[model samples]
Target: MHFLNRGRKLVRTAIALAATIALAGGGVTATADRASAAPVTPSPIAQAGTAAVKGSAKDGYQVYSRTSEAIRYTRTYDGIRVYGGDLIVRLKNGKVTGTSVGLAKPLSLSTKPSVTALSARAKATSAFRGKITSSGTPELFVDASDGTGKLAWETVISGWQPDGQTPSRLHVITDALTGAVRGSFDEIESVSGTGNSIYSGPVAIETTANDTGFSLTDPVRGGGYTCDMGNRTSGTCAVFTDDDNLWGTGANADRASAAVDAHFGAATTFDYFKNVHGRDGIFGTGVGVPSRVHYGSAYVNAFWDGAQMTYGDGSGNAKPLVALDVAGHEMSHGVTEHVVPGGLTYAGEPGGLNEATSDIFGSMVEFYANSTADAGDYDIGEKIDIRGTGAPLRYMYDPAKDGSSHGCWSTTTKNVDVHYSSGVANHFFFDLAEGTGVTAYGTSPLCGSAAPVAGVGREKASAIWFRALSNYFISSTTYAQARGYTLSAAADLYGFCGTEYKAVQASWTAVNVAGDDFCSAGNDFTLALSAPSVAVDPGTSGTVTVATTAINGDPEPITFTAGVVPAGVTVSFDPATVTAGEPTTVTVTADPGTPRSSAPVTITATAPSVTRAVSLAVSVNSSAGCTGTNGDDVAIPDNTTVTSTITIADCAVTPSSTASVEVHIVHTYIGDLVITLLAPDGTAYVLHNRAGGGTDNINQTYTVNLSAEAPNGPWVLQVRDAASADIGKIDSWSLSL
Candidate 1:
């Protein structure tokens, strides 16, 4: 299948759809469009071990900032590479500052493969539908894309496509032990999925100045250029050159005609990504990808081969496949490949997601252009008649309109072909952008009695999708994960309380994709905290708003309670129990004796069988209270020791770790003085041991932990002059419990 016109193509390319990067920071196979990567050195701590059981950066999956001095490493268990075993280390001022990891759990398995390499290769080759010209050695590796790391074999099958005109490179993944077909990545990135010919008319295109005249290259935009395939199936194609740079006559016979649409599509797609999504280029590095037009005689498809975009002239050269949306669609595949490591795997639900990503972005690009000749709409390949009939390749508003696509999800959603399974997400994106029922685009239907949804507009919807795809999505991300990540993206972009966040939840549900957490739409109520955490001093109080929204039903009585309260801390609810809807106030008070420490506090709301909870980090600050002072002075001769007692009483709790002691000693040689605190249990904690030379009095405050001792008892202050020089006296001393 190729871009937009999946079935229109004679044979599948199998390259673009097959390269899935199971792990972030992991290799994307040497031939996956990008240059072969060098083996990433692993940090000493980047191991597939128990560290991931803790669910932290220590797990080996890490994120790095481009500006930070961070080195990324991919792990290998035994001998094979551990795909998800990724981590990053950062340095500051020539010192190791921090590290993070991505492994979800420890991976410990025998590297020895039960299945032979030939057997694995056979299994992988059997899955490849195209004719094979050659096969790669079956290499062993750890497939940790699913979080459960296991031994797997990767085999590359390269050859001519079934069409015989286009080439095919299919990467098949097989389980090493079971020899079962796990997944595959194809070279052809299809939209199953438009530009002109005959579609978009009289469009402006950028060109580069050459020695003779002008080349179909946009030096202003990454130097990407369009070329003619010369009706040949293989070999390099000559770059298109024009004299006046006037180029196309708005006709396919002009040769430069289809080239005009292809070039405009690449530039428009580039602009849409840069201006709307802030992406620098197809690969985010500001580097442009080349586009080849008029590929093969009467060819019927266009594809984003890991490296470039190739468009075939339609049947009889009468209908070229270079429509604006189709161009945008093919170029989008490159963005997907570059944005997400090796790109989304081209099989099952992930493959559908990959296709839907292109379609959605392509449609958005068309909308962004809003060309007068070809007005934007939520349709794919509406201009080019790739389907023989005048119908568009796929309808975004109603994917099922094409007959094979599933508008709603089901148990077998993951098992269907990527082209058809994409219907779910395409329908969802449409609902998200235009809402359900009649709209400017088309009327959208709801699934399984889903709640009515309101549109969030294309700008917000596209932003949310791009954010999720680039940041939160992994190669194996499924519909459920997509739902969660998109909601997270919406919340990140437009706060959880806004209409945008709610629309994300509503739209996903409208397409029958359910998630655990919802912003405002569900059968039960929803709960969220205004602030995730708070800090307060002892004897003070902090308040957090507990908001609850009843979704799709009436108020279910929700009783609010604090899970665990630390010592000297009291938690109170404004209204302990209420019907879930109105916001509740949670007041946390720390007494004067509360210690300076932080702990996780869970605020739970229970109603019937539904329970919602949020964690609030409570930090209590210690106070300088409970001080016992004595103003009377004690005489101390040279080399003699004098003790002062300040009895502590009426203290409710033991002293905190930050207990303080104030000592005032007058001496000619202050270096001879030593001060200490004696607890009621006779446990002496040294405060200071003489250090000054021949100085004056020593007046200072020392902080220490007295948590283990009694709060109400005699706390003695001991001062001694170790050196026999200049007699001194203990002026005064005090103890703060």
Candidate 2:
């Protein structure tokens, strides 16, 4: 947004020329056809003129004099309609020589010299009007024929559509014309690089030749300088001029690839405007414009000098500041100048507003451009390498990073240096466009807890600011005025009492720029602090933790109140009460916060002094347990011996059930022991137990008997413990059949 740049000065001379374009005062109108007046008759004036006037003047006058109040016209001599100024007949060697006249005014002849000039003047005056319309370029076009539809001149006429940054005027001029087009040039303004370098320049039929550094094969200097793909050097550096023999030394970069990079970057910027912002070029109309790069000696700035964009390679400490953002910034100045009269002048708040306006739109263009090579960020001049310390020119998020002088603005902001003073407004834009929040526009990551606009988000904030910029805020908008304009715009765009309107008011307050009472009455600027919202996973089970914090600006402490915790979830906070200036984390936990399982838990911090609510995402996790059954347990008697029947549990999921269980006993003595299996209900079948004593412990014979009336299912076998040492451990056994 800074106006003083090295390259800008070099092109300073051209500013006056462009500014001299008459600020016409008319609108667009329809032109009438005069094709019938194509032939015959000559005027004494035409005969008095040079032999070059081979055609008939009467017919030409008739053809050219077709009038239309709405149309702008130029000059007409003996009816030969032309776009430029007056016409005159000069005598050379006693013969009619030729004609010449000023393009700004027209000429003709009457019976007397003074009368003829006066008549021509009157006719010119009557035929010409100052009004300009969007006929072709974003410029002021004159009514060459006094609003009549006629060929004003053979000069080339081009058009440009301003991208709303400035007044969209059609550029009209009268000059010697040639090429395929005849009598009048009628091609629409060609837009290259879309919005990158919006201009009306030559439509080169062929592409520019690639510079392979073929000229560098032979060098006058003994020392060789390498031209790598990315390396850039000042075009004024000795090596640049000596090795490459390029004229610009010291201030410009002479890399072989710079031209391509600059061109592509400009093209990308243009495309960004056209594709993203819906602009034809720099101006909304497709105006062919030149994108001059590598300008001047070690120049460290870029600017749109009323007509074209100029870039300069910075000093040793910096590189060219012609990045996409810089390009957008310069082009935006053109837009500003078009829309706001005297926008370029530096004065008071309007000046600061002007600067900030450029920065804001520059950033917007970057955001809109959204190039892969350079993703849009709210940072300015990050790639320029000015400090050689990796600090951008300005930080929209935290302008204070540069210095306090350039940070947030107050009433006294106008007192600071223009560069630093600019920050206050820049910061306001940042705050207004992006609320103080955790995230901005999705990609704009925020610093810890410095949320923009307190309660609202960046998207709404940007919309409010954009509307304010285009609608309510005038060229001389102050911080207070900005607040009001944005509020009104928000209400209009989002509806009265809508979240957006309230958010806009709150955002202005957060930035300390609250507006009048009318807009502020319904808007709340107080921080609406609440706990974090609930986040969930897909499946399984888990817990969600909710943390609470009192909104910083809240007048007093708030009592933490929990909202509906998810099923299988729990909620709590580190410190239930949130004291002023002390933010508390209200933790909401889920017993089994399973994966993909989530619920919304709102934690309201309410008090007579203040009220705030924060939502936490209570979620479950599924990554906790293994896929199958972990382990199993079984029990068997020691002394008694008997075959035990047991069924193992399968690995299938059993939500809230226990595994099957079984018990068995064995006999260790020589005796007639019978083992009978019985169900828990006392049902049994056959019983059989046998023991042969080989080591004198016991000798027994077991008989297998089947009861005819026995019901057989799962049964138990009972046996007695024979050994003395194992007697206490082995409880008694019984057979049920």
Candidate 3:
């Protein structure tokens, strides 16, 4: 197998250019199918306080079957990219068939930010941890992945992790008006190595005959070729050329061996998506993703660089990370990014889900290959022996057996690394495919006393997962959102809440991910917030539109009321009672005396037959003056309380009715710590009481009112570590009075 690696970039660029021209909007631009006439502005629920939702759409890509076609659209609002706002439309012949939208609701907010780009970047800089290399310009957009629209400024902070080896590209989202850090996700997704023409024995691979020799390039599949990196970290790779078309002898020394595995993997994974899911190719438009094997002298990991795939020779340069499933796993990352538009952010719950997605498809592809030398199984990296223990890197049946991965969802699940945190979804998938208790794969333990989930078979499970990924999931999807979307996918595939849907729910519940019985009643309604979040100054007011739609239920009168208003705030809903298809105006007024802080105000919507509640984020602000910070790191001894101090000098002013406490702590599980800010007068305001389930780190801003206290002395940032084994340090803390 021989290929010219020097021309790789140029070929990819040409394919991309063709796709752009075809889509009618270069990679970033979009074209909308807006009607020729002026659009109706009264639709989409956000009927007050904003102008018409101006937007456009461009065809990102499309796929086809015998009689049906699916088109993907990359969208923008007011001239800005919309994160989690992708749309997919399926049609038969010239008629509409189905459609999928990533946005929770339509965008109807100002693109302009109250906070300047400089200010937003500074906020992002603080949220970013580790050593800094460079930063990106702040971009503005509407973050509507959470069922509501928010004007946000996104800043990408690039750097190295604490280890200085693993790089970081953290995208931090900040509220444009309040400057509060809203959300974050990393760019670098990681996975370890394993492979064989060595792992798969002597497998048949496709190659293209060239003037010089037979090259390891598939002419039938977008001319995708596998090249050797010559054991270098980065350089031009050479295609493995051979005198004869036959290649690989089941040895790592033969570079063609790894290339065979990689080439075959790319082909098989492409076939899996095309034959089973109706997706045409990796890019959905016949564009093949190139692969570079033998990436480093002794690299132990492999990764997807957003454009192509790269594999490393493991320890001693004896093991190439090019196993069939490994290749499938790496390429599936590209698929996730391609199919989901922006791909799931590679951090927190989203990252874990993304990793699990790769693993799931990797196993499925192995099964699809049906090679006698390498049988499909639930274990990951088993062929490579990644840990040098003859055991796989992860056991889908019982992930915690590795002593790191989470076997079930918990308060601390989202706090762990993406690889280990992936155990929850991984285990859930196993349960869905093989059922609970014991199976051919292994024994999968139930999270609690939850009922068992019957096997739905791998085909059905995979279809459900793919449907959710392509149709329902977006970039900020959490395990909770995943459960809902998968349920919807299951309903779409099978009948609503039928055996397949119930199996999905039961499997999720068995993994400690609780969800409502959405199909329990035929009558139901959905709620969406026009403005999900707002930053209001003390003595000021902000409004949100509570929009409702009837779902599987008759039109009924729905009553809206405040369920969780802050102590010093008053909430009143205009037209408190309306039909299910109507919208209500919710105004929250923060009194001057209200503490300067943020909390979720729940608006409960009740109908005669059902009840639903949507939460609104509210933060109160005042002029900042009493500011202090302690930047020293304090070791958080297990099960012990540690304190840092910040003294203020504002003698005349008390404190903002709601004051902000920005704390940065590097911890294994911040969910195990109770963090409270103590006033100089000994009054304490609790910020976090062992939250986030099982997620890690406490590096964000928290707000609460400083009540009846003088801002003239030391204000203590107190953290109590209530867990054992895991530990961290209080990196820094700041006070805004």
Q: What is the C-alpha lDDT of each candidate?
A: 0.70, 0.38, 0.71
The RMSD of every model to the true structure, in order and in angstroms, is: 27.8, 40.1, 7.7
Best by lDDT: 3
lDDT at residue 329 of model 2 (Cα atoms):
65
**lDDT, model 2, position 31:** 38
Residue-level lDDT tens digits of model 1 in 593-694: 577666789898998858888788776754544667775658878777788898876766567677768766656567788888889899999987776555
User: By TM-score, is 2 or 3 better?
Assistant: 3
TM-score of each: 0.62, 0.37, 0.75
The numbered model that scores best in TM-score is 3
Prediction 3 global C-alpha lDDT = 0.71
Q: Name the candidate, 1 or 2, with the larger TM-score value.
A: 1
Provide the lDDT at 286 for model 2: 52
- What is the alpha-carbon lDDT of model 1 when measured against the actual structure? 0.70
Superposed Cα deviation of residue 600, candidate 1 (Å): 28
| Model 3 lDDT tens row, 617-645 | 87676534557667666889999999998
Lowest lDDT sum, 10 consecutive residues, model 2, at: 15-24
Better of 1 and 3 by TM-score: 3
